[model samples]
Target chain A: MQFIVEDVVTHLAVKVTEPRIDAAIATPFKDKLREIVVKSRKPIHLDMASVDFMDSSGLGAMIAVRKSLPQNLGMVLCALTPNVERVFRLTRMDSVFDIRPLTAQKEHRE
Target chain B: MTPIERSEPKRSTRASAQVQPMFHRVLSAQPETVRDTLQDVRRRFQGEVSDDTLGRLELVLAEVMNNVAEHAPAGAGAPDDSVRLPVIHLCIVRHTNGLACALTDDGVSLPDECILPRSLPALVMDDLPEGGFGWFLIQDLTQALCYYRESQRNYLAFSIPFAQSGAA
Candidate 1:
């Protein structure tokens, strides 16, 4: 459940430091993400490059966090590994979130 | 009920005549123990299978085992090594096209029969669901899945192909 938050140009970017996001860490992951999301009016960007695996619980936690956000505030997910990306695709979550490729050096949301 | 054997694959010439299938059994209601067993199983299949296959295996096992850990009541004297631990038995057998896995747990049965959704609900942004994705995810990841209850045990059997494929 380790993450680092950075204030990007207009959005707040949170990079998850964990290699695996599953049932074991989903609750804490949600809590930490919610804390950050609640304080920021800017949109949120989640950098998931270090996450190699994510299970249903982790996916649910992400959804929960997204739901807790204000309607005008947006959320984006970036750099999902193939393993983690597969879960997003399997659950059709790819369509719900703004997913970006690993090589996207910079993303700006207006 | 008897297990189903669908399209058993011929043994590869490189495989030994006596290479046994992989199996792991543990008696614990703790989720961490179940997670550890999954890591052990992944190591057991490390080079023999594709990463996609292993990921699917891990996903399905985690979902089911977590369900067991969260819901199953501690049975009386089922654990010899650790008293009051629930038992989970997993067996994986290689098939011609993929792998067949079965998970057995001494836990409570599904409330109104084993009814798992075959597909996920539509993802509407405003009214999205936070939970109820476990069984749907399981169904989407596996080639086939079956659930049954007998003799006070819950059995879930599924198949995983060595391809990067799943239902959305």
Candidate 2:
């Protein structure tokens, strides 16, 4: 899986285009996220609209990215597809992250 | 040609019953091909599966096929050096109560240390997110799941209760 990082205002938006985010491809995705966070400003938004599947591996990577951000300035938000959203709901991680609708302003900002 | 005499042999054959018909198929390991194969299976079965069961079947099949593409050994110049082209072996068995599916592939077996936990909390807390949950979900959704390794092949089997209790 490859994640494309785009800088929107001061916040970084990361888009995951892969359909499956499980153990098989988690490491590459996490590595790319780490690379992006190191150079990003603050308030990262993860656009998971194209991601149809996410297992624990993907969730762990998201959490790791959240933790790697600057403590005071870092915020992580999720834009989940309906199917992927179900996974978040099932795992109750929706409560931890600032999950917004796919079409919400934060997600639509390109 | 008496009606009673002719029907007696037919009735006895039905009662004795030969071996149940078995179905098997092998398909390419491409991700796109997986969906087509699934659709074909559903069509061939004539919508025998309820909606809920169909959803579960799709999820489980996707999980296993994804694993095959990621973990199996790859041949030279394979699309992704990740795994050689995987040979997926699928078998469906019909029993009195339900249908059983056994999917076999030439991929690495589940790691010895990665036994699925018996409880959901253990799965949520002990397993780090972004990994180690596919098998857990498969176990939770299916009626039964088992894994075995023989020679160089990995066999994963799962079954669902098919006798309809009510509408899905």
The 0-to-1 C-alpha lDDT of every candidate, in the order given, reads: 0.79, 0.64
Which stretch of 10 consecutive residues in model 1 chain B shows the poorest summed lDDT?
A: B74-83
- Clash count, predicted structure 1: 1
On residues B22-126, what C-alpha lDDT tens digit does candidate 1 reach at each position? 755765656678778888888888887888788888888888888777675544345464545567888887776677899888777765423545568667877
Residue pair clashes in candidate 1? B9-B96
How well does each candidate superpose onto the true structure, as a TM-score? 0.83, 0.58
Off by over 4 Å in 2: A1-10, A19-25, A73-77, A103-110, B1-59, B65-87, B91-100, B106-117, B120-130, B148-153, B160-168
lDDT of 2 by residue, B47-161 (tens): 6656545545555666677666656554622667754566789887656656688988776676854345543333342233544556655665566678888987778887756
